[model samples]
Target: MHRFLIPKELKILVETARRSCLKKPDLFRRGGYHRDLQEIRWLLDNVESWNAESRISSVSAYSILEAIVLFFDCLPDSLFPSQLYSTIMDASKSFKNSLEIYNCLPEINANVFVYLITFLKLVHSHSSENDTDLPLFADTFADVLIKPPAALSLSQIPKSDRDSKRKFLGYFLANDVSHLFQIDLLLTRDEYPLLARHLVRTGTN
Candidate 1:
């Protein structure tokens, strides 16, 4: 199901997430254009070209996923000041699709998925502290926490698998390299297996 990698639905989700990022005008410093954001916008706009194996390497697909996570991670906590809950809730719906397919994705993309989920959990936590009314992402947050991503299960990985083409989302989850990629800093107890697996992989390879 390589088609799952870059389908119309995935493209729409990226576009919607991009639009949500742009809605926060203060994301850019006064008088300075957000050149970095433009890169992500371009990626969203040219989804077809990037997904084309002949045009850009398929490795670039992970770039698209990483860029989406970075967009929200880089934003200030004050994003969508006036309508934070509604706007992020809408955006989270788009991201929830990624979460559903977390196991099917490649390494970097899967890491991005975990990071996004963590980000949403933090957002929901903050919102509920005062509002009492849970944010829209509450359900998604709960669902992900209950199952955790299959990618994060280090003990389940086979010992002899070494095909480079093999997707490593699960491997990444069981590893400690998330910090190297600027993913969320707070590692949960469930992520300890990830660190152990990462160490084993690094030593063996």
Candidate 2:
């Protein structure tokens, strides 16, 4: 239930799908079609054994993407954190200000956010080759990244508010995150020590 640090399950899901999503143009954009609740739950329960078993390997990229989205959706606070909702959704907020806002996130949250956004940016860079649409990605991820304060319900969000939030996500997709983060996509090596620690699944975790 803690909303600060991301869990191992999420890292596993994203890492597992990283290659396929990047290489298969459709996988990153379309994600996967099998967003079944049962599958997501099954993934959550069994992600610990991912390296030891082939079960998770058989799951579609769509299900992996769905499980990742569901994980954030169920967090005590959404990825952007409720306290910054208004500031983040402000349409007039400058691109510089958005980078500042990202710095405001807790260390772990910021790292993970940068990590995920960096991946999204990479996928977007291949948009022409991958055929992924940024607007749709923005719309779908808006609810996941930003939302009404904890006191409010998603059902209560107005259309204008929704649009603003989606636009906010689009900014991250459009910009380079290296200004605020140190991200190396090739996590297979030992460089970028700080990020390498977060990307890998440790026995102690």
Candidate 3:
């Protein structure tokens, strides 16, 4: 198991993003901004035997990737391209181990979905701002394409039973699932233009 340390660079990025979001209250709801900031703080303050290894694990890797994507999305377009690409590449490579780790923690599926959605948003935003072609790797939905069997299996569960059990679990766990949908919606809106253009251009080719 690879030990995961919170890199100083990531810490700085999270803090900077949090500060930027906080400064622009009009751009995002207060509650959303606070939630984002709190998530970062939790990541920073928490210490567990798994903290180091979590980045390599599929379940935890998604959470880490989602946080990074969110932070990166808030950054100025003028930021160093090479640095951003290097960071994303590292995260993508690490996520390759997510399948093994995911087997150990089935409940983290929602987090994985959210992370992929966030990643899509990041790539779309990058393409839009740079007026450049979208990276091919960004074309597929990683969570859906890479883990469809797992997702389909989950979807096979009876809706009534699933809802009943989820209701009993109350707001906290329910909110986690809802967050995935929220992230999905955000990504859909963010990437629609790029996706449309890509589809049109690809069809012609």
Candidate 4:
């Protein structure tokens, strides 16, 4: 492939979680599957080929959400790579800094990063039924998406800076990163937009 396509698996998991969690009160409290590595692998492998609209009743919200979390875990270079961690933090409270940070990322990283943020923003918007507020969502994802330091024992990342990644992520969740990522979620568009279409908007923009 000329360019690494944003993994359809991530899209599949996001879409699956979106459907599984809708209108379900305290879905996080119900808690789907997070620890079952075997099950998570199965979900990723099986649904990787399935269309975004496709769904099965057996899949639980927690399982889908956990799968998404693991998706980030599987990344060799995090959504916010360690090299740019400082730049991202500097931009945390400034729109101009956010744009600069966006420009600094690789195309694939930028697109996938935006895609994920878009999906999570949608999830947060419906937090009323799911009991997932922006802070909770941001804090939950910070560990996965934000790479603290290559070596915690080494004197690389400062202690205070290490502790504040979640606050920065919460800032992003509360603001607009869509302008950075042009992709539009299917939920906002057609009744059942394909992942391809959901992502295709980036090309047009």
Off by over 4 Å in 2: 1-6, 23-44, 47-54, 153-156, 183-205
Encode model 2's per-residue lDDT on 78-122: one tens digit a residue.
667788987887742566677677767766667677667766666
Candidate 1 lDDT by residue in tens digits, 1-205: 1111222323333444343332322221122224433444454345553342222222233343334333333322211222222222223333343233443434433444455444333333444232312233332122222222234455753332222102122232223333423422333224323221110001000
Per-candidate clashes come to 3, 1, 3, 1
Q: What's the TM-score of every candidate structure?
A: 0.23, 0.71, 0.21, 0.72
Return whichever of 2 and 3 wins on TM-score: 2
Query: What are the per-residue Cα lDDT tens digits for candidate 3 across 77-186?
Result: 21112222223322333333332333232222334333433433443344433232223323222221222122335666444432322222222221233332322112
User: Which has the greatest TM-score?
Assistant: 4
Candidate 4 residue-wise lDDT, 1-205, digit = tens: 1122365566666666666666666644444443343454554554534633254335566656665666675565577777777777666666556667767766666666677777778876887766777777766677778775576544766666644666666656777865665443323222222222211111000
Candidates 2 and 4: which is better by TM-score? 4
Backbone collision tally, model 2: 1
TM-score of predicted model 2?
0.71
lDDT of 1 at 121: 36
Error of 1 at 204 (Å): 48
Comparison by lDDT, 2 against 3, better one = 2
Root-mean-square deviation of each candidate, in angstroms? 19.5, 7.9, 19.2, 8.9
Candidate-wise lDDT, in order: 0.31, 0.59, 0.30, 0.59
Name the Cα RMSD for model 2: 7.9
Ranking by lDDT: 2, 4, 1, 3
